[model samples]
Target: MAWNEPGGGNNKGPKDPWGGGDQGPPDLDEALQKLQEKLGGIFGGKSGSGGSGGGGGPAFSAPLLGVLALGAAVVWGLMGFYQIDEQERAVVLRFGKYLETVQPGLQWNPPLVDEVIKVNTTKVRAASFREIMLTQDENIVEVNMSVQYVINDPDKFVLKVRDPEISLQHAAQSALRHVVGDTGMDLVLTEGRAKIASDVQTRLQEYLNLYETGILVSKVNVDDSKPPSQVQAAFDDVIKAREDEERVKNEAQAYANGIVPEARGGAQRQIEEANAYKEQVIANAQGEADRFSKLLAEYRKAPEVTRERLYLDAIQNVYGNTSKVMVDVEGGNNMMYLPLDKLAEQSQQRAVRAPSLDSNTLREITNMVTEQLRRDAAASGSTSRRGGR
Candidate 1:
């Protein structure tokens, strides 16, 4: 008989263990119990009906528990050893209290009793801040700046401040605002940028030191500073006007510098010329007075002769400069004419034609003048002697 046929072989026994004849599936509880019994047999035990392994099961041993505990302890102890990088420092704390700082390297701390916080001390860090702030001039500007810093004391960085970086940020912002407030907007935007940055850096450092933040500020730089965008054009116009004003002032100064020296030179020249004229006039006056005094002494010695000689000398000097000579013929009706002007004009024409006067020609002119003067003196003497007769 087939196994599927009911009551075929063991109709007295309960149907089929797998319930193959339209009994749907086996009972979940019975299947699970059978699985448990099979597992127990593999482990050198018998199937059990209660939770206590009532039939038979493997027993727990003290040796196994010791092995597990030893493994856990080893893992826990291993976890206590942590590595610190070359650029890092670790702060050691015991039972939530301060202890000592540890240098960078392989470090060990009691896992549960001690806490370690690793802080980067050798590496530089940076933060940037920006704001639209008011200046001492009551002007508004947008100031952008950055600060570079590093952790100097790991203990203070980790324990002294709750949040070191946050405190630094607040300090930096406050310092920047305070410095900006004390400075003029033009300076903050222009030539005073470096100074403002330095001021901010100093102020921030002071604040950090006061708070014991343990952050060393490396540098503070004002990255960007400008007027508000809405009125930037107006500010640019003002700058241009200021530049022009400066240029004009410089040009005027240069012009004055050039002109002032020339004027001073001219005035100095005038003063020197006046002084020279004064000296010349005074010298000429002194010379003339001395000559007159000598002439007067000679006149006192022989009055008549000296007067005649003086008159002749005056006539000679006057006649030497001109080509015309006028003579008064005493008691004579004839107007005696001497064409000395015509003669002089002819002489000048000859000189222009020849370009040079020969030595003999000059000698002849000199002899003629001497003879004329001699004749005049002789005539005056004869007339005086006749008057005496």
Candidate 2:
């Protein structure tokens, strides 16, 4: 049953499947030689030759070695297929020279021929720069700022500069220093922060363009700006003083706005009143002059009669305004005068003191006024009779 079992044969080694004469699990050398010759027949190489030239051990399996090498090559090629993220771009270089850029996706390249560099084109990157800078006002301040950017051209980013990010950092610092240096310290430290940041952004973009850094600046922010620690208190005081100054100026302007209009209105009112007064005075003078001219023309026709009429009219006007009445009788030697204003004043005083008047006192005063009037009338009649004679 067994090839090497001993009992049934007479001077025989073992049963031989290939008609071998002897066997104890066939000779190890002869089996290897047969395998080498068979391999030579298949590949057309001298299979008579072993793996290590002239070796007698079983030839190393050629087909198995070829299978292992093929597996290794497949793995290496698979390793070249890498994935690029949505925010990134893949710049491909072949044989150390520019080839092409790839979009975001799974991509492949020849394992040894191509090199890929992934650049983030949509990710916003930030660089912070801080430096002690001199301001246009000749004061020193610490300016801390940040710049946000993105890679716009991945090829230029990788090939144009040896280290684009480091160059960006330097450019940011230079731009910040230049902007701060051109701005006043008060502005840099306070109200002008946004302006300084904008100026820095513009300058940084220019620098990046000049250097072909392929960076697009998105925004620039002024993080912190301040005077040195030794002068911070003084700067704070100065800031407060400036605020107070601004407040005072605003208040003064408001006051001027309020008072100026009112003053102008008052002045306009005064001017209008003066103009009315001037018009009224001129009209009155013109009317008086015209009346005088008319009266002069009438007087030229009859001199004596007009003179007498004018004298009586003057006396009438004067007497109408007076508190007392006076009569000059042509035939009488004395003038008769009635102090009616004084009598009225006395009556008013009495009425104010007593609130009532006595009827007997009013009767006695009336009798005296009547007697004086009768005597003046008799004298006027006597004068008239003598003139008729």
Candidate 3:
């Protein structure tokens, strides 16, 4: 017989062990009919028993219901388990309210009873802000800066603010402006930049703390701080002037360094020269005093002899080159009318006397006496001959 026939040989085993026939598995209508029949049997209403007595199949299948329950539990358990990385933290919420914070590791929660929001708490986030702010000197300056922050408290990070990143950016801007407003333009552009950045970080941390944003500001760096580009050249000129002032000061210092020692050396030389001159003058004066004192002692010891020697020296010094002639007017008794010129001539003749000798002494000085007498006789004869002629 064919399988499609109602009493076919294929129907010998009671069709399908699970209850429906092999009509390739039961159709939707057939399955619904079977389900209704099972329900009726379960309630003791009717089954294919052909009696009003309500005897039926087993009420509920224990094995198939247990299988469905076990499958749902497996799926729910998988949903409860989560993994957080080293750089992440998990915020668990119970019934839409924050419950506990979980650190990095494998964690579990009741499936539908709790929810986990994973946050990257250790991740460094950066924010940038730029604005025009007034300086301490009332000058407007535009400043650009970047801030690095990290989530320190995941619970506060998730629940405290609407947008933490945006709030951090605004706080950085406010803190930067506050710091810039208290500083001068020169300081902002130069030495105060680091201080300004530090102050901004501090103030930003305070502000974030106030808002409970749980953002820990690690660093703030000022990228650019200056006047507007339109006046950049003018400010550059001012900077150049300051540099020039410093340059001039350094040059003055160099000049003083070069000149001061040279001046000191010149003054020192002058002092040495004056001291040498003083020493020479004192030495000469002492020598002169010693010579004068010796002469005074000699004069005190032999007054007359010293005077005679001094007089002879004076006369010899005065007339050493002159010839002397002496005339004795008193011997002639001038009543005899003596000739003055003749008498002077005779005295000069006598003053130019020849040498004479006694017998024994003459023998000793004979050669000298003979030469002198010859020269004198020749001179006298020449004068008498000249007078007679």
Candidate 4:
């Protein structure tokens, strides 16, 4: 039965394992002394000498505590082994103080004595949010944006900030607000989203660097921006109106481009025509002046002959254009006239109508008329000579 149960074994009084003599438990000091000796013998230590100077309890437990401590240290060291991927970096700290940053690979550090923080240096991380903010035009706009980043320095990322991602989130919000607040509502909701995103990225990176967050911002994207639902229709109408205005301006510019060149060409053509007319007038005037100058030189050599030649030339020119000629005899009261053009016309008509009028007969008739004119001129010249004598 049980060691403390009564009336169970051999019909004897209950036995005490501690060697009690009066059916009660043994003395605390004496039992403890015996137990210490037994444990000392088991651990290969000498038992107490039963004197004041010999104690085996401390000696027996010393080696056991050392072995336990060594085992704990070995477990702690094993716990420190960590594998880092190719894209990660590790930051090590010893005794709560900054140590060295380790590259990606298998790494180990003493547990409880050194701290290790692993960060993915080449992996891009993303943070995104949607918020409402006021614009420069005092209009409220809802902005949806995302920020992409990577850990540039693992040491700074782990050590310089209490929470790097939280800090990045706050910095991103601040930068987005600053950019949106400085822009007008039309730009925020329309074509200026790219510019705003670029500005937010630049400002956010600056803030992260200043705070030593070690977050390198890869890109910032303004996904969507618009007025609240209550004013969305009105904003759409405004955008359409602006687009129409731009289209009208472009059409007017195209029309002007088409018409302006044609008008300029017409004007240039008129100018060229005027210049050609001016050159023609100048050439005619110069030719007339040169002819008059040469005639004046010939007149200086023989005044009377030049005067008579000029008169005859004028008469010849006048007669050459007419069909009739008038001749006045010097001493006779009669004037002679000849219709030579009428005669030539009658002869050509007769030659066409009558087959009896040959070319030879027409030629002989013309020779007779020429002889009579020559004789009349000779008679007039002889009469003039007699009158002069």
Superposed model 4: Cα runs more than 4 Å off: 1-22, 25-79, 95-97, 295-389
Worst 10 residues of 4 by lDDT: 50-59
- Residues 17-53 of candidate 1 have per-residue lDDT tens digits of 5665435445665566667677656654454455422
lDDT of 3 by residue, 1-389 (tens): 44444665555444454554643554565455567687866755444542333444544566756877999999999999889999998999999999999988999999999989999977888888889889999988889899988899888889989898888878888888888989999999878889999998899999999999988999889988888888899999999999999999999999999999999999999999999999999999999999779867888999898889779988787665444423223323222222446755865686579454357874666578557755655666676667667
Query: What's the lDDT for candidate 2?
Result: 0.85
- Candidate 1: the clashing residue pairs are none
Error of 2 at 298 (Å): 2.7
- Best-first order by TM-score: 2, 1, 4, 3
TM-scores of the candidates in the order shown: 0.66, 0.68, 0.59, 0.62
Q: Rate the local accuracy (lDDT) of all candidates.
A: 0.84, 0.85, 0.80, 0.86
Clashing pairs in 2: 36-47, 40-47
Residue 213's lDDT within candidate 4 is 94
Q: How well is each residue in 133-250 modelled by candidate 2, as lDDT tens digits? A: 7888899998888888999999899999999889999999998888888888778877899998888889999999999989999999999999999998998899899999999999
How does model 3 fare in lDDT?
0.80
Estimate the overall C-alpha local distance difference test score of candidate 1.
0.84
Clashes (candidate 1): 0
Scored against the true structure, residue 5 in model 1 reaches a CA lDDT of 48
Worst 10 residues of 1 by lDDT: 52-61
